[model samples]
Target chain A: MAGGYVGKILKVDLTTKNVSTEPIDEGVAKKYLGGKGYAVYLLYQYIKEYELKGLSPKDIDPLGPENVLIFATGPGTGVPRFPSPGRYHVMALKAPLTGSIGSGNAGGKWGTSLKNSGFDGIVLEGVSDTPVYLAIVDGKAEIRDAGDLWGRNIFDTTRVLTSVVGGKNTSVTCIGPAGENLVPMAVIMNDEHRAAGRAGLGAIMGSKKLKAIVVSGDQKVSVANPEEFKDVADRCLDALKKNPVTGEGLPTYGTAVLVNIINNVGALPYKNWQTGVNPDAESISGETLSEKYLIRKNMCWACTIGCGRVTNVKSGPFQILASEGPEYESIWALGSSTGVKDLDAVVKANHYCDELGLDTISSGSTIAAAMELNEKGYIPEEDLQGLDLKFGNASAMVEAVWRTAYKVGFGKYLALGSKKLCESYGHAELSMSVKGLEMPAYDPRAVKGIGLNYATSNRGGCHVTGYTIAPEVAGIPEKLDPLATEGKALWVKIFQDFTSTVNSTINCLFDTFALGAKDYGELLSAVTGWDISEDEILKIGERIYNLERVIINRLGFDGKDDTLPTRLLKEPMPEGPAKGQVADLEKMKEEYYKLRGWVNGIPTPGKLRELEIEV
Target chain B: MVMPIVNVSAKILLFATLRDKYGVRELEVKCDGTVRNLLENAAKTLNKGFLARIYDISRNKVREDIIFTINGRNIKDIKGEIGIKDGDRVAIFPPLAGG
Candidate 1:
């Protein structure tokens, strides 16, 4: 409690309706830090304390009450790099969709506000007897009935809650009807557009009958040494302002700047890579999005990089008049992957998914698979309620979004994710995914280290797990050949550990991309009073990563489970700069195993000791 | 005997700090070899330590924290070996902060 954490972790047991808050020792906080770091520690604590046992016919679902939803924030959050402060990534029960621990970062202010409310994290346990939302402001907290708002989508629910509670500044993280209905791809939405949108953690939240987490904190966050932190932070911010991406390009175009670049690099996986790169990429370019549909831009509290876009569609055949993002990931999934290059169409699809609180990345990916199936005549138009579902059909793209969000007809299967949909279509290999989570925009074969990250991530295929992308694809700090398989395994491993550590600290990743790891240690030291070396910071990452690995492996993902979707390995890039190339997974995996110090892909004893991660 | 290799004209978009860091965005530079040559030439103009921040560090892992997107692919993908072509947009980004 005397260290990085706010000193306490809150646990809500819905089965017994007992609310208890425990103080994590200073020792654990110092070792684990907060946000994602504490999340892993909390996962171990929750699992060790409450393990689900043998099931029964009456068991209903096997994941059971022992599976807790741990939402955590870090100490350096809200102090610098500003924005709701702190990271709010999730660690959920192994979802049926992907069968891995789905933890994703959600922008907006919930994580920062949660910490501001006097607790480092919130662990929702058991299942509630009825529908409710946990409402917390400053240090005051309560679980209020959400019966009236039960069927409401994200937009209406947030509006109602905002009025009922009397504030615009109050940040609300809520699930949509999809989550309320336990759709596997449902996502938790916050600040209207930002979602902790992977692995169906939202479905877990919905199953608990917890609709939203409303938080507003006016209190200032306390750092171990504010003056020292302020100096470093101020210098960092000034330097950031002087740089280009964080300083100019990102602020100017947001992440959409990648729309043109990735498109040109032939990195964008279009229409399931039935075609590798779109010829009419300009239609979906950031310049086009900004010129035609760009409306207003917004930033998360304290975030200096305003990479978030809010836009409006003045006229379209779509119902989505307004929406939040077509963040680089969503743009890829809903746009090129579906063969719909029209930016307006992408925005409309994004709006639909967000309003329903569905995960845009997964939702878009699964629908694209459906469209691919439809194009191949695997399913008919009647299967889509008369919607002419075909790749490149904007109308069908729009329809698929509504159908999946509302779970109408074929949309029901699509909601389960592309992995299952592909299997149903008799082509499970077409899904372009590793774990149940849909792949981000970057093509793995084109970026070697990203492929390694996707294969080894405890959550199955995930970019955030390692983001070897920084080195593998986007030469942010260094250059590497996208076509090369050498040295990538080790690259993915350290990054996974480092990123997990960053997530634990609860800071926005956009910060670390521009700065050094020592600066991170410094910022962290000023918050917790703990002297941590870069090696120690990296070790903390290994600790959380292994902790998550233990959870997912315990839930079924193990050495055998860490694999790329067959599509990535067997299918060569049909066209573009990466044409004729497929991920050389055999060499890559072997190299990765060696770098990880894992014996035949199983974490070695020395490696376990190095991370201090308990098996 | 020495023969001349074909030269390609490239356009790069430099903004704000970099505009000041590098005096010109549209310059006709002839490259007979690799992008590394271009980067080295640009490095000569920048303040000491600035170029090192964007390339692999002394301790190595790559200090090129700056985004040097080739066609939009982070040069990390193609390496510095990507041959330049006429009309290619080779944009280099420094650090940034407005959110």
Candidate 2:
């Protein structure tokens, strides 16, 4: 037990209705830090233990009782002094979609509440015979029947749980109908809208018959040296305020500001990756949103840089009450990718996704793939059940969101996600995914470094895994030629390693725009009483990354799996600044593997030994 | 012997905070000199507060945090006394970021 961490890990077995607590080893904490780092290490340990008992690693079902769902927090989480301490939790499991290392990071009061309620992390194993919800109140845990809450949308579930559990202070994270139906795009949403939205961890929750987790407590998180921690925290805060991206750009316009910028560079993915530019990009741009619909800005707990947007289309065909996002990714996924320029329709779709507990990126991208298929005559009008499934068909897009959540009609196929849906129709190439998970907003061909990051990402097709866009587009730290392949492998390695550490800290990734690796090291050192240096902290990030790589490799992935979609490699950008350019994935993959000390995509024995990872 | 020189017109696009403050997404700025001169002209047009955010008063250099791009290329890549041509799209952002 040490300062910063609550020092207790809770393990709940729903099948046995048993709960146990254990002291997290200090050695393990120092090595993996926490959040994604701890989750990955613990998951690897679990898988290894299982394999020792004769179950093959590849045979472990992602949705079976064997799969472990982890909700983890880091030492820096819930610390008031830390910049963006609001980001305090990460959800990790064997993703049903990618079937590899699946993880998602989120920000809100939930993580802080969980930590304050007296646990650093909670691990759920085995399946419950009946639907249940876990409630942690003042350091004690209980499993309650969730028969009444099972099929409700996230918003309704949160409201009902808050009333039944306690009061306004109770933070509830729950899955909606999408999760209950085991839709692969399901997201676990908390605070009504914020979600651990990728990898279908929500579906895992569904598979376990678990509904929601509500936590509320008043315990204070202590630091080893409060004075030292405050000083470093202040410096970090000052840096954030002084940085234009964090202090001004983000807080003011939120993430949607990138629409025009990305489109201007011709990096915005449109119409299922057929092109890089969107003619109606400006119509749904952040500027337009701010001018027309933004009601106010929002933030997570302990966050000074408020980048969250609360928007409302007060009166229109797409009108609805004020709601939380339609962030840049959602806008791109539902708008540009689907070739629908109606901002209100996109916002409406975003609202539906949030309410239904779906990952907007996967859901929207899935619809886009279906649109392309329908247009190509792969899907007949009868297949859509009289619904005109065409790109830019706003009505169809809105309806698809609702249907996909409920797995109704053609939506049943959409529920399988783009990769599965496309494969079923014998057009997997049109899916625009890697490792079965749909791609995010960034166009790989336009941004070569990001393309490499996408292909080799442990979680599959994720931008946050290694956001090369900072250097490639925003020029944070330093500007790199987006088209250049030389030295990109080295950059991707650095970014990926650094991001692993950031995710482990459970802090908002936006903090990196202002703070450097040393700043994070100083914050952690003050909180944990460890004299950690910048390079040492970065090494921990590298170790965590390599550990995840080992887990995926052990599960049967190799260099062949580390690849972009065929369209990204074979098809050139048809127009705009990126016209005629394609991702040089092979070249970057070779250099990336070498830099990672990996043979093919698997970590070499020496590399494993160097990182102190046991095979 | 002296004739007045005509200024070149370039479209200046501001994003995020700059856009919010300027009250317009894009504007046409006329400058007959280097990119620095165009920025200075924009500073006068948008107000000095905007310029103070992008330029360092003490160093007399473009603030490192200001991401200045000309026709989708970073100004740093273009090299030397960056000149702006008529109808060229110059995008100036205040360290903008998103996923």
For this target, which candidate reaches the highest TM-score against the unseen true structure?
A: 2
Return the TM-score for each candidate structure.
Answer: 0.87, 0.96
Each model's TM-score for chain A is 0.95, 0.99
RMSD of each: 5.2, 2.0
| TM-score of model 1 (CA atoms) | 0.87
Candidate 1's residue-wise lDDT over A339-382, tens digit each? 88777788888898888988877888888888888778787566
DockQ of 2: 0.66
Which parts of model 1 have CA positions greater than 4 angstroms off? Answer: A50-63, A80-86, A166-169, A319-321, A380-382, B1-99
Against the true structure, candidate 1 has what lDDT?
A: 0.72
Model 1 chain A worst lDDT run, 10 consecutive residues: A54-63
DockQ, candidate 1, vs. native dimer: 0.22
Deviating ranges (above 4 Å) for candidate 2: A167-169, B1-4, B7-9, B29-63, B79-82
Question: lDDT tens string, model 2, A4-119?
Answer: 89999889998999998988889998998999999888988887898899987788888898888999989988888688876655455478888877788888888888887788
Interface RMSD of candidate number 2: 1.4
